[model samples]
Target chain A: MTEAILKVEKLKKYYPIYGGVLHKTIGYVKAVDGVSFEVNQGETLALVGESGCGKSTTGRSILRLIEPTEGRIIFEGEDLVSLNDEQMRKRRRDLQIIFQDPFASLNPRHTVQRILEEPLIVHGIGDKNERKRKVVELLETVGLNKEQIKRYPHQFSGGQRQRIGIARALSVNPKLIVADEPVSALDVSIQSQVLNLMEDLQEKFGLTYIFISHDLSVVRHIASRVGVMYLGSLVELADKTELYDQPLHPYTQALLSAVPVPDPDFKRERIILSGDVPSPSNPPAGCKFHTRCRYKMDVCTKEVPDLVDVGNGHYIACHLHR
Target chain B: MDLDKAGENVEEDYVLEVDQLKTIFRTEDGDIPAVSGVSFSLKAGETLGIVGESGSGKSVTSLSIMGLIPKPQGRLSGSIRYKGKEIINLSEGEMREIRGNEISMIFQEPMTSLNPVFTIGNQMVEAVLLHMELSKKEAEQRAIEMLRQVGIPRAEEIMKEYPHQLSGGMRQRVMIAMAMSCNPSILIADEPTTALDVTIQAQILDLMRNLKKDFNTSILLITHDLGVVAEMCDRVIVMYAGKIVEESDVRTLFKNPNHPYTKGLIKSTPRLTSEKQRLYSIPGNVPSFKEMPKGCKFVPRCEYAKDICYKNEPELVYVGEDHKSSCWLNIEQAPSIEEDAS
Candidate 1:
């Protein structure tokens, strides 16, 4: 946990909304507005929030899959935002991303062999025979057998396709993998299998993951640290145990309480927030969560709170908290 | 003297009774038996939850009860008695009267369930008028009141709008409002909160719980999430491959789950409060009915399956007082459990 593999400072990705016929920029949709975090080596940092909260945009921004509006993405002590196309492409070898949909992410036409070998070929890592050997080895690492190499993506089930996705992410021996909702689309029984395979693979390869998901239980199980997002900003950041045990921020507390515990005998008081998440395009004044926050005060609707570290690296953004 | 009279002791107590219900879909390929001999009863104001993953026939069972299964595609058998009256053989007109008036259902996707072209007020008033002998003015007034009761702000303005004008949560609230306006004796909520996010899901679940208490209406809640079953249900039935594998009171099912599948399901779901090294996942895909095994459907994935388990299908037998499990292990140990209980 000492060495930081990735550091993001005030990262922002704002999509410009255009006006009528003239097509002029009317305003910007601050999708990922002023978000920041760091990932230590071999530790999973989970970004959790509902849809339209910019969690996916942040993940894509770090990978430079989506162009950022502002801020620095420092990977291995170098700012990634400043790198040119060639340099960024070279840097991409160490940075990879796995999408949420297994069915859509993989090319339908390509067999497992071709899909796995594409990364090695593009990176100029090995000869044809060596690349073929590496593809089979990658498949073995992700728990897929050699016989599946000849099959296409559609031929496999959701879990197996996810394994293929994981196998493809590991083909170039990348250090970091931005897994965005990897298991949410899978069935409950299959979700656990995929999660177990990921944990095992992470241990074997010393991989750092930025797991973005909405399910709190899955996040609590896998993440070393968690960042709670709301309306394109980090509301709270803490260790997984500390966050779940004593969440300081109102939004974090509400989110943790809202998630239903599986055990029928285990009854916890749930904080049911009224109404839905506000539109990210036209956010409310001051604290974005003020509309639904139970502990809302006058100052909450007047001034925006900064992310302040209370103690032991637990940071929260709320008016009630220091 | 009366053989059928033996099953009448508890029949009068329940608001709805479903016995030996099986629904088979006649596909082009072959007959796919989805819901096979499912039996359960819902008492007035009791929330009976049916939980299963996809293809477990949870939805089909609800559809069968509601008489919503499309004809020429489905074949339903067995008894569905509402207020001691069988509904399976009723005509379309009588069935429609019971469907919207006596029993209303809210499906998972509110966006698709509610008509797109109709205004929220228009459709809601239509449901009220069709069910009750209310005038247009009274029904419109009742619709607005129902919308407000479900916590939709600006109810008057919302009714004038369409379904697409509302968010997923708002649309669901409207659906609940429409369903509750009739105040049906039994409400079938089929994965009502699965489409929304967690925050909104919490809100909807709270609304359902409160509505059940205030109206004293029974609910046939069907969902895949075990957490939801724990939070909202009085009793639960865990289904697997078109059969009820386990049925018991909510607490007993969670604490002393006898079926291996039930145990695996509880273990596999990650607890939000604790950290587990790895989740215990059940292996193998749910076998399609086309190539289903002859014996127990869960035979391929049961960790405790013995030679006998693979030879014959286990019937749902009483393993404990007021609890049942369909597993050979439980059947073999039934006598021992009886001795222990005594």
Candidate 2:
């Protein structure tokens, strides 16, 4: 059996909404609520959802970037929630995150060399000479040349800047990298290049990735296993083939059908959901997707459905499945 | 310059015809050719898609046709005819009559394109008032009807609301409603649903399709998404470095693409139906305007580039029935490399 590198149990991140004169907490934006998943070593687990579905928040909460409100994040068999800030800082060497926008993430003023070496310096990995050498190695690994080390972030194109971002994330040699919409900002041609580089790196490093993106096509290309999220909850989780071919949940079925296929002759029977994703702050009780779900029943409005495995490690959370 | 009278009596073959159109921008660093000798035509009730990457000049081509390019730094050459009438060198006042009434454009970011401070009713009514010779009440009624036509529920309440009050999908629908409010002969949509999510994107695309069917509006779709192109467009134009490298019917463009850039773009896009072990990526970046190569614009990144490809740029030629591609391989000895190894 493959070793599980990171396991997230009932992860919940709620940002309090302030209201009235006294600034009393009226409610919480349930961005990520009761999200549970496990990442095996050297596998890409994609978390996909819409804009306010809490895919990004789940990724951030896994790295303790946003400080998840509840649930345990057990990494390498250690409970990260019990750890202090200083402990978490030291533990972060094994955990790194690559952001969506390459333009905004990197320090514009700093050179690529300085930007890369900062992680090594903060982690106390090696000396100046060794760190400098590692930066060049990181650049070469990500398909960039050593000559570009002195240049700033603005000097590179969108694809090259993304390469720089990847190199920075790889400077410390993290085991798990939470890539939050890594290639969404890039054009189609450049986006493929980055995706290939990421896959190659995963093979070379035996890395674990919690790939968070809204684009299902990209997710299908990179992920070994897929988890579908709806309004901060995991609606369905299955192997890539099983999920795409035979999705259990109605929302997953709709989302899968919604993707515009590239072939001109392919006419998919699309499930265009009416209305927008509801406000996360006041999300519907029981099933968050009931408002948009096509097969939503009366029981879906009253009782919350637990993510239970039916067969072949395929888990689903829906009243129909239950 | 009545809106109804424009393009009303013309029994022209093509609704819009662009011949050898070139747009150059003068910057601190010399004149950069944003669009170079590009030519295409839009027939009545046809959707022509211009597909390209960020700097492939697709948006610039659309903007040039719209007469939206800034006057001081940008210069336009060649011909743009609307229903057999020259419109390239028309005065600003003359262009204004045709801008929204004859043709309208919907931008990528609806939030930025829309006036945030003004109510939706005000913006829609103003657009209608500018083009159609209708009273305020009539215009307001027309705006609400247009909004309802685009599937906006509670149209009256939405009319009173501001731009920020609606979601991304709603905002794009508003932009579409405003653009179609004038019953334009041609609608130029530059990455209309690029900002929204996939589900919302599907909804907007469906709306656009239904609207196009109902009104028979000719659409000039400019986007980087191949899937969108495959679904919406009847004819597709693949642009690279300010030139049309390939032009064909949508089926031919996807099935048997002639240009290397077109092939690469089609292969690179991951399809939901099929699974590719590794996505085939083009090797290098798109060359900047200042650092453009001597011959083929895609030479640096192209795998099939030959010696002759570096010497002289190949002209866009008919490669198949209703298909055109610009590549030296079509004219000269083909490259030694086998195609579609992946």
Best by the lDDT measure: 2
DockQ of each: 0.81, 0.86
lDDT of 2 by residue, A198-290 (tens): 999998998899999988999988999999999989999999999999999999999999888888889768999999999999988888888
Q: For every candidate, how close is chain A to the native chain A in TM-score?
A: 0.98, 0.98
Which ranges of candidate 1 are over 4 A from the true structure?
B1-12, B333-342
lDDT of 1 by residue, A133-223 (tens): 9998988888788998999999888888999999988888999999999998887898999999989989999999999999999999999
Estimate the TM-score for candidate 1.
0.95
Docking class of 2: high
lDDT of each: 0.90, 0.91
Q: Model 2 chain B, poorest ten-residue lDDT window?
A: B1-10
lDDT for B57 in candidate 1 is: 96
Looking at model 2, the pairs that clash are none
Question: If scored against the real structure, what TM-score would every candidate get?
Answer: 0.95, 0.97
